[model samples]
Target: MPHPDLLFPPDREVRAIARELFALTRDLPLICPHGHVDPALIADDAPFGDPARLFVVPDHYVTRMLLSQGIPPAELGVPSVDGTTVQADGRKIWHLLAANWHLFRGTPSRLWLEQTFADVFGVETPLSPDTADDVYDLLSERLAEPAYRPRALFTRFGIETLATTESPLDDLSAHARLAAEGWGGPGGRVITTFRPDDVVDLEWAGWAERVERLGEVAGADTSTFTGYLTALRSRREAFIAAGATSSDHGHPTAATADLGPEGAAAVFERGLHGTATAADAESFRAHMILEFARMSIEDGLVMQLHPGSVRNHNRWLHATHGRDVGGDIPQATDYVRGLEPLLSRHGNDPRLRVVVYTLDETTFSREIAPLAGGYASVYIGAPWWFLDSPDGLRRFREAVTDTAGFYNTAGFVDDTRAFCSIPVRHAIARRVDAAHCARLVAEHRLDADEAAETVVDLAYRLPRRIFRLDRSAA
Candidate 1:
C-alpha cells in the first residue's frame, strides 16, 4: 500500500511473480515510437517554464477534469484566440489542482502525477491544499536546474529513440539540427512523423490554404490533381530525409476509396475550389488513405491509421479555445468494411506495414483482431486515448491476444503530449503487462522464462522492430 508499489497486484503468490517480472523490465531502455512531445523543447534544450505551464496548461487530461467540475478554463490559464488575457499566476493554478487532488483519487492522471512528483522532482509528500505551496516552490526550484532541461531528461529517461509528429509544412529544423549533430546513434535522439491530416482532409479548417502551402513547400504545382499527388510524394521524401520512419493519419473514419484517376481528379477539383459537398469531402478523405498506403508501400515508412473520434464535440469550447482542448470525443468505428478497399490492394503485401488503432472497443474482438490475424501487412495498434488506462489495457490484451496473438500487435505507444508523463505512462503499462503475464504463470498458461521474454517484447523489442528503428536513419 506504499507509494512505491501502488500498482502491483495484491495476491501473495501472484504479487511475488509480478514483482519479479517487473524487475526484469523496469530498467530496460524506453522505446517511444509514437508521441506528440514538441521537438523545439529538445532542439533548444530550454528549461521548462513553470509548474502550471509545464503541467496544467498543455495537458487536456488535467484541464478537462477541472472543467467538468464547473471551473472555468480561464481560471486554469487556458489560452484564448481573440487576444484576451487569462490568469497570469502560476502558484494559484497549482493550488487549484492541489485542492482538487481528491477528484483524481482513482484516476491514471493521479498515478502519473504522483510518480512524476516523487521520482522526477523529489516531492514525496501527498499534494493537498496545505502542501501545495511547498510542493510548488520545490518544483519551481527544480525546473530551474540544468539537469531538468529537456535534453538532459531525455537522456536520463533512458529513451533510445523518441518520435514527434509534424505536418508537411514543417521544415523539421529541430530534427535537422539534431541529425546534423549526430545525436541519434547512441545518445538520445528525436525523430519526426508525417501527419498530413491538415492537408489531406477537405473539411478541415484552412484546408485550401494548407494545400496551397504544401504545394509550395514541396516545390510542385497545386493546380492539377496529378501535381498534388506528386507534391504529397515530395513531402514524404522530405520527412524521410529528415529521419522520419512513419506517417500518421487521424481521419474521422476509416473509410478508403479506390476511385479511378478521373474520379479522383473531380474530387480534388471540388476540394481545391472550396465547393466540396460533405459527401465529396468524405470521398476525397477516403481516397487519400489509399494513396497514403500506396506511398507507404513504396517509401518503406510505416503507416498508422487511428479513426473514429468525433473531434471537437464541445462546439462552445472549440469556438472559444480552438482545437485539441479535450473537446474531442470517440464514436463507434467499423473496420471490416471501412478498410476493405485499402486492405484489398495492399493487405497481402509483405513490404507494407500498417498499424491500425480504434476508439471503439467493441470492434477489437469482432473486427480488428481478426483482420490483423489474417493479414500479413496489418498490425493492431496498442490501446490509445480513452482506452489507455489500466483496465482498458487488460481488456485489450484479453480481446486481441486470442486472435491476433502477441507478434501481430505493434507494442505499446504512449501517444502523449504531457512530456513528464511519458515515463509514468510506460511504467504503468509495463506493470500492467507484468501482472497479466504473472496471471498466466499462476494459471500455468505460460512458463516463467517464456513469460519474462513476452514482457520484454511487449515493453521494448516489439516497438523497436515494429517501427523499424533497428535500421532507421541515423
Candidate 2:
C-alpha cells in the first residue's frame, strides 16, 4: 500500500499543506501528451502475455539498470534484433528480477515498480529472492483476467487523452483502427503524434529508404527537393487526419536554420545520395527544424523539440538489441544560440506552439527558462527522460518557476515507454508538485487556496491548455 506521505515534505506544517494540496489532484484525470506505449496493445485489447513481458522484458529502464550491474539482457529474456536466440521461460526472468530487486533501492525505477506492485497488482509483501515465484504467480493470474487488458487499464487509469508517437514512414494502421473504433479526436481517449525523425534526420541509417517509403505512402515524388517537401506535408496532413495535434522532432541539438530552398535542395540531394558530409547532414537537420516550424504555423500541429540526447551511446548494445535499450546519454545543450533562427522568425507568432524538452538539466535555469520567458511560442516541457524522478521534478519546479511561472510551462508529461508505470509516474509528479507548492505556502509566499489552484493546473489544466487539449475538453 502507498504511504499517505510518500513524496511529501517531512516537516509537520509543510507536510499537512502538501497533503491538502494533493487532495485537489487525487481524483483528477490523466492527460498524457507524449508517451511510447505501443498502439497495438490497446487496439488488440488482449491479455498481457505474462509477468516478465509486462514489467521486465520491454522496459529499458528496468533492463538498463540490470544491465549496468553486469547482468546480460539474455538472462532477462530480451531477444535480439534477429530473434536468433532468446530466453523463453517467464519464471526464470521473474526470478532474476526479484533476486536483483535490491539494486533498485533509492532509484525512480524502484518507486514506480514498488508502487505498481502495491497499488496496481495488490501486492505489498515486498519482493525478494525468497518471494519471487509467489509474486510472479500472482501477476500471471491477474494478467489473465479480462480486467487487466490494456484498454481496461487505460480506462481504469483515468487517462483522458494519451498520445503515442509514430514515424512518417508508418502506415498508422493501428491509429486508423483506433479511430475506426472511436478512440480518437480532440476529445477522444487515444491519439497519434507526428514523429518525423526517421524521415528528416539525414544521418540516420535508413534515411533514404524511409523518405522513399514516405513518398510511397503519401503518393509524392521524392527524387527532387520540392517533391520531398510535398511528401512531408502530405504525411503531416495524414497524421492530422488520423488525430495528431502535435509533431515531435528529436534532434541532436536545439539548432535551427533558415536556408533558402536552393541551398537546402543541394544538401537534400547530397543527403539522399549518401554523399553528404557530417557537417552537411547537421545543417540539413537544422534547416528542417525551421521547415517543420513553418509547417506547424501553416497547419495547426504544435511543434515539440526534444534535443541533446546522445542516443544509442553503447555501441555493442545498440548493434545487438537495436534502439531504446537505454544506452542514450544527455550532454550540455546550447539552446539560446541554437534556437535563435526559429525564435527570431516565428517565436512571437501566436499560432505556433513549440514545447521544448531537454535531456540536459543544466539548461533548465540558464537557457530553457529564459527562452520560454522571452518567447510566446516556447513552453518549457516537464522534466523529461532521466530527469523524470522525485528530486528531478522538484528541481525543475525550483529552477523554472521564477522565470517561466506555472502557466508558461507545458505541465507534466509521462514521457515513458512502460504502460504499467503511467499512473504511478503521474502520482509521483503530483506529489512532488504539491510538496513544492507547499513549501511556498509555508514560507508565506502564496496562500493555500492559490497554491491549490496552481497544482490543479499542474495536474490537469496546464497540460490540456498548453498542449491545447482543453480548447475542446475540460
Candidate 3:
C-alpha cells in the first residue's frame, strides 16, 4: 500500500512543502493526450475478465520483468502468433506472479501494482506465495462487480480526456461507436490519434497491402507521390472528424528530409514495385516526417514524434508472437542534425505544434531541450517509455529545466497500454514534480505559490493546451 507521504523528500521542511504542492493536483481529472489503451475497452464496456489477463497478460512491464528472470512467455498467458498453445489458467498465472513478486522490487511496476491493488481493489495484504490464493479470490470477487467494468472504471478514474492511437489503415469503428454514443466530442472523454507508421514504413510487413487499403478507405489514388499525399491528407481529415487533435509517428531515428517532388515520387514508385533498397526506404521515411510537419501546419493536428527505438529487438519472440510484446531498445539520437530540415523550414511557425519524445536521455539536455528552447514550434516531451520511472522523471527535470523550462515542455503522457496504471503513473509524476518543486523551494529559488501552480500545470493542464484538446471540435 502507498503511504500518505510516499516519495516525499526526507527533509522535514521540504517534505512539508512537497505535500502542499501535491495536494493542489492530487484529484485533478487526468488529461491523457497520448496513450495506447484500446478504445474498445471502453466502447464495449465489458468485464476485465480476470486478474491474470488484466494485470499480467497485457502488461509488458510485468511480462518483461518476469521474462528477464527466465520465465517462459507461455507461463504468463502470452498468446503466440505461431499457433503455440500457451497457459490459459488465470489462477496459475497469478501464482507465478506471486512466486516471483520479489523481482519487481525497486521498479516502477512494483509501485504501480501495489497502489493499484490497494486503491483500485482495496487489497492491502502484501502479495506472497502463502497469500496468493486469498488475494486472487479477493481480486476475482471485485472484478466480478459492475463497479469494476472498464467504462465504469473510466468514469470512476475521473479521466476527463483519453486518447488512443490507431494507424491510418484503421477504420476507427470503435471510436465511431463511442462518438455515436456521445463519448467523444467537444466535452467528451474518448478520442483517437492518427498514427501513420504502418503505411509510412516501406519495410513493414504488408506495407504495400496497407497502403492500397489506405487509398480505398480515403477514396483517393495512391499510385503516385501526389496521390499518396492526398490519401494521407484524407485520412488526417477522417481522424480530425473523429476528434483526433494529434498525429503520432514512431520512427527508428529523428531524421527528417526535404526530398522535393521527384525524389519522393521515385521512392514511392520503387516501394510500390518492391524494388526500393534500404537507402530508398530510410530516405522516404525521413521525408515523410517533414511532410507530416507541413501537413500539421495546414490541417491543425499536433504532430508527436517518438524516435530512436529499434523496435522488436528480441527477434525470436517477434517471429513467434508479433510486435509490441516488449523488446524495444533505445539508441543514440542526433536531433541537432536529424531535425534540421524540418526545423529550418517550420521551426518559427507558431501555427506548427510539434512534440518530440526521445528514448535517448543524452538528447534531453544536449539536443531536445536546446531545440525546444530555440524553436517556437517545438516542445519537449515528458520522460517516456523505459524512462518514465521516478528517478527518470527527476532526471528529466534536472537536465531540461535549465534549458527549456516548464512551459516549453508538453508535460506528462501515460503512454501505456495498461489502462489501470494511468492514475498511478500520473500520481508518480505528480509526486516527482512536487519533489522537484520542493527542492527548488528548499533552495529558495522558487516561491511556494508558484510551485503550486506549476504542479497543477504539469499534472493536468499542459497536455490539454499542447494537444489542442481544449479547443472546440473542428
Candidate 4:
C-alpha cells in the first residue's frame, strides 16, 4: 500500500473541508497553458524510452534535490550538449532516487511523483529503497506500451492545451508539423512561446553567432541594430503563424529602459562588434525590454516577465554539465523602479497584457500586488520555481489575495519538465485554491456559492482568460 503520509489534505479537521473542495474540482479538464516540456515528444508521438530517462533525468526538481545530498548530476543521466553518456542503468538510478526520497518529504515534487505513480501508473506499493527495482521494471514495461506515448498520455491526462517554450532561433518545424497533422483529432493545439533570452542578452556565449543565425532565418541583414530588431520581429511573426499566444522573457532583473532611437542603435552596434561593456550591455537589454513591450502591443501576444533568477550559480557545473541542469538560484528582485520605464509608456494601454513573476516572495504584498492591482496591463503570476509547492501556494494566497484579489492574479502554470506531473500539479493547485476559498467562506467573507464559482475560475477559467486560450473558436 502507499504510505499513509503520501496524500495531501492532512488528517485534521481541515481535511474534511479540503476533501469536499477537492471533490468539486478533481476531474476538471486540465489547462496547462504554460510549461517547458519538449515539443518533439508530442510531435513524434513515440513511447518514452526507459524509467531512468522518464523519471530521474528530465526532472531538474528531482535531480537538484539529489545533488544537494552530494550526488553528481552525471550519475542521474543529465546529458551534456555534446552528447556524452551519463548514468545508463535505470534500476541503479531508481535505487539512488528511492534511497534519497526522504529529502523530498513535504515537497511538491514528492506529492506530484506519488500522485503520478499511484493515480496514473496504479502502483500500489510506495516507492522506497526496497521496491525501487520492482517499480522501475513495472514502469519500464508500461512505458514501452503504445498507450504511454506522449500524445496518448496527453489525451489520457485530459490536457486541453499545452504551450512549449521556443527560442527565437528555433525553426518551429515540429510545432508546424503537429498543427498540420492534428495530433489530437481536428484541433490538436500544441502551441509555441517566443523566448528570446539567448539572443536578447549580450553576455550569453555565442550571442553574435545566434544573432547572425536569427538574421539568416528571418531574411534580414542583421549586421546593424535596426536589422537585428527587424530579424527578431520577423521571428516573432513566424512563431505567431505557428500558433503562439504569448512571449516569455527571463531577464536577470525586471529593469527596463526607454532609450532614444540613436541610443538604442548605438548599444546594438556595440553588441554586434562585441565591444559593449557590462553597463552598455545591460542598458541595451533594458532598451530591448521596451522594444519587446512595443512588439507585444503590436502583435497581441501576452508578455510574461520572469525575473530575479541568478542562473548557473556553479560555474564549474555549468562548464561540465551546461544550463538548465538544476544549478540556477533565486535572488531578491525589484519590480517598482525596475519596471517603471516599460509601465510608464504602456501600463495604461488596454491592448497589452503583461504578467510578472518573482522569486522574491516579499514583493507579493509589498510591491507586486499593488503594482498589478493598479496597472491596466499588469497581472501577478502564480508563485514560480522554489515557490510552486503546496505551502508556497498557500502562503501566496494568504499574502497577495488581500490586495490583488482573484482577478489581478493570473492562475497556475505548471512550468515543469515532467509531463506526467502536469495533472497532479494542477490538481494540487485546485485543491489548495478550494481550501483557501473554503476558509474565506468559513469567515463569512464569501458565500458558499461564490466560493464554488471562484474555485472553478481559479481552476479552469482564469488561466484561459490570462493566456488568451478562451478564444471563441478554441
Model 2, 1-474: lDDT tens digits are 899999999999999999999999988999999988888888888888889888899888899999999997878888888886878799999999988999999999989999998888787868999999888888888888888888988999999999999998888898878888898754568888999999888888989888888889989999899999999999999888877888999999888997789999999999888998988888999999999999998987889899998989997888888888877888888999999999999999988999999888889989999999999999999999899999999999999989888888988999887887899999999999999999999999999899999999899998887776766642
> What local lDDT does model 2 show for residue 274?
92
Candidate 1 residue-wise lDDT, 1-474, digit = tens: 134455667888888899999889988988888999988888888889889998888888888899899877788889987867887799889999898889998887887888898877777878899999988889999999999998788888988889989999998888877877775322237888999999888888899898889889999997789999999999989888877889999999999988878999998898888899989988888999988888998998899999999989988878877899889999999899999999899999988999999999999989999999999999999999999998889999999989998889999999988888788788889988998889889999999999999999999988888888877531
> Which consecutive 10 residues in model 1 have the weakest lDDT in total?
180-189
Error of 4 at 255 (Å): 0.3
- Which is the leading candidate under lDDT? 3
State in Å the error of residue 340, model 4: 0.8
Candidate 3: C-alpha RMSD after superposition: 1.3
lDDT of 3 by residue, 43-98 (tens): 99988878999999988888888988899788899999887899999999999999
lDDT agreement of model 3 with the native? 0.91
RMSD of each: 1.8, 1.2, 1.3, 2.2
- Runs in model 3 deviating more than 4 A are 472-474
lDDT of 2 at 414: 95
lDDT of candidate 4 over 252-284, digit per residue (tens): 889999778899888878888889888887887
Clashing pairs in 4: none
Clashing residue pair totals per candidate (backbone < 3 A): 0, 0, 0, 0
Per-candidate TM equals: 0.97, 0.98, 0.98, 0.95
Pick by lDDT: 3 or 4, better one: 3
